[model samples]
Target: GEAMDRRRSCGVADAVCDATDASCTEGAPEVVQTTRLYAGAIGQATAHLAETRLSWESQPRNIAIFLRRATKELIEPFEMLRDWLVSRYGVRIFVDPAAAEELVPGEATWTPEQRPHLADMIDLIITMGGDGTLLFVSSLFERSVPPVVAFNFGSLGFLTTWDFGKFRSSLTRIFEDQSHLNLRRRLHVTVVQFDEGDRPSQVSEYQVLNEVVVDRGSSPYMAGIDAYVDSQYCTTVAADGVILSTPTGSTAYSLSAGGPMVHPAVTGVLFTPISPHSLSFRPVVFPDRSVVRLQLPQSARGDAQVTLDGRVGPTLRPGDCVVVSISAFPLPCVAPLSDTHTWLASLATVLHWNDRRKQESLTSASYTETIAAARRAGEAEQAIDGGAREDGAVFDSSPTASESLDDRKTADRRRGTRRDRDKAAADGTVARSPAVARRPRHRRRAAAMEQAPELACAETIDDIESFMRHA
Candidate 1:
């Protein structure tokens, strides 16, 4: 009843609807129609394990399934899943021409040339394998991209969120209720070929899900690239290469180049120099709105090449420049409702963030006790030689230590003797011998002051001033 109501409200004619249905006559609300879905697997996997194909006769909603080539092992599971999707959900299925012969057997298939037409009609995209497979699917849709639900079937699944084991539950939730999606920004790259006069002659553009790299392809000499941000000259990079990355790409190649790990939600571009000749030239983060241009200098010793998301692009001559900026259309990635903070969890798992040996902690009480014991031993040794004469029965000082102290005393005595001699010479009195002069001037002054009790009584500056006044 609900299905008929939904179909009828979506502008299915009253002729198609039951005429006796009371709701069809009056105030029936309009409903949004769910349309065709596109699903595909990466072509590069050696063995395709999935089997079973959707039956053409019993399907309801239009669906397209893409595959590379099917091996004997893959044919059963592939067809089984396809049939299940169609029979359970009543979806019409489309297959790729390349794998249609092996998987579908007799079903008519769409070729690669029909991708443009297919892109327009597809309501959603389902990708199997890793992040690379998802990237391939994104490339198919040049214009607006349908939301992608990626299954983790390949190694290093930084982008793929759905697990193969829970595919049924994950798909059920998506179809039953609309889920929160992560909008990952993509980069728009333009390669400009400069003519004889160093003017732009030809332009080629590409979309990158990850980073764009400008590198010295095979030359022994470093790549010399002049970098500019928002038309303002930034710096000439002398390095193996330079990586221009988005926030989503920051965790990819840019992270390996010592760039900051930016969250996917952050709107920014990252510039990371690879093996930079100058240590001062490090990674820089720019606002998403900024236009980044990297040009190969005329003096460059080697041919520099550009790569978009690890896919090699045009090789640059001396005057060629590559312009990179954020694209207006972002990729809508369907996330599993179970794990909301997937990025954080992925960092811990994929990057081995928690893979560390447990460190041994010090026993605080034992450590403190050990330190105290050492200190007490030193004090006990000093106490054993009861404060004796400087050179007799005292704590045994090392020869070097004793010599250092004696030298210091000798220098102080010499200084005191020199001062006393100068004062005696001024007063027309004979200078004392070295033995007699060993006493410091301050000690002698103190003894002289003691002889006059009044001066001795003046201990402070105020008392001394009063004594001086009386004298």
Candidate 2:
């Protein structure tokens, strides 16, 4: 009603033409329109001022909805968003071929394709699944990708941080040019395959949000991969495989393969080896501009397989190589306003990075309680023992000291008995010298000393005085 009132008061409604008319194009002398308004009617396009970034002229009119799967759960939301977007704001929709039947009259179906100038065709990309769905969308456009707004539906939603519940408001903000965009770098990998003649046969290119892997798939023998950086020989990885990743992919397969977790904002490439046979083959970080290449030696026995973002690619023949570097166009993921720390939060939430059990804090109350408990324990021991000694030394008054003294007394008695038996035996039959008949007088006196009372050692001053007097 308000928009209609504004249109009526300015007489703009009188000049408005049928949005679906093929003759009425933006900047056409027939339309005579001052502002660039996107036509949301079927099979129609309006000119964009700013191409990809969110701005007044870059408002998303043709939004492509990509889902992780064609399940009922995702299809329902797809239809709901389609209805809400078209009915309220007259936004055109593009959907997957699987969900084409659910499209309304004005809404259109979208098919994924490998187009270079896709941004010129579509204004925005809205993904309704997990990070994998977003990766699939990223893989669609080789260059000039539109801004993507991803909603979390799958598990481990590190990349898909936006909630579907607040999608309406998010889309509103995006249309109003008020939403924040998290731009993540992607790796562009080109694989050049060679034939037996050592000549280039085929070249395949891919855009990966995660790591590109070259591994010995199902092969018992180790893979011998020669790695290089910017045309300089780096090292040969003799292991299961090697992974080249972007900083955005650092936390993914590369990290699992013993690669360092580089921040997404960092402009670097990660070279990680998977179970390398050599102990010295460690993960290395190369500049973003540096082109890292992985190749199989010509003397290789088995072919090494290549995988880009978990999708299997062509096997690399002997002398074949893969070139990896930063992509030209970065992926603009829609996140919360000022939520640049979402990646850090994902590290803690999803990956459980640096997660540890919190230790007990030492507070004054706890310390005092511990001291009181120790004092009470000492008091209980004192009650059991009758009283403590006046000596300042702890070992002297402790029960352990008394128990040890008893042990010494018992030991002395055993020694005395053994000596007395050995002496009494005529043939020295008590496991002693067989030739000895009787022991010496000094030996007998020593045995008597060993058989003395618990106070024999004069452990205390009073015991010493009493022993001297008795002697």
Give the TM-score comparing model 1 with the true structure, all chains together: 0.61
Best by lDDT: 2
Residue-level lDDT of model 1, residues 2-90, one tens digit each, is: 54344334222211222233444455454334332221221122021011111111122555555434445445545776777776797
TM-score of each: 0.61, 0.65
Ten-residue region with minimum lDDT total, candidate 2: 42-51
Model 2 misplaced regions, further than 4 Å: 1-54, 101-107, 111-117, 364-471
How much does candidate 2 score in TM-score? 0.65
Candidate with best TM-score? 2
Q: What's model 2's lDDT at 183?
A: 56
Report, for every candidate in turn, its global Cα lDDT versus the true structure.
0.65, 0.67
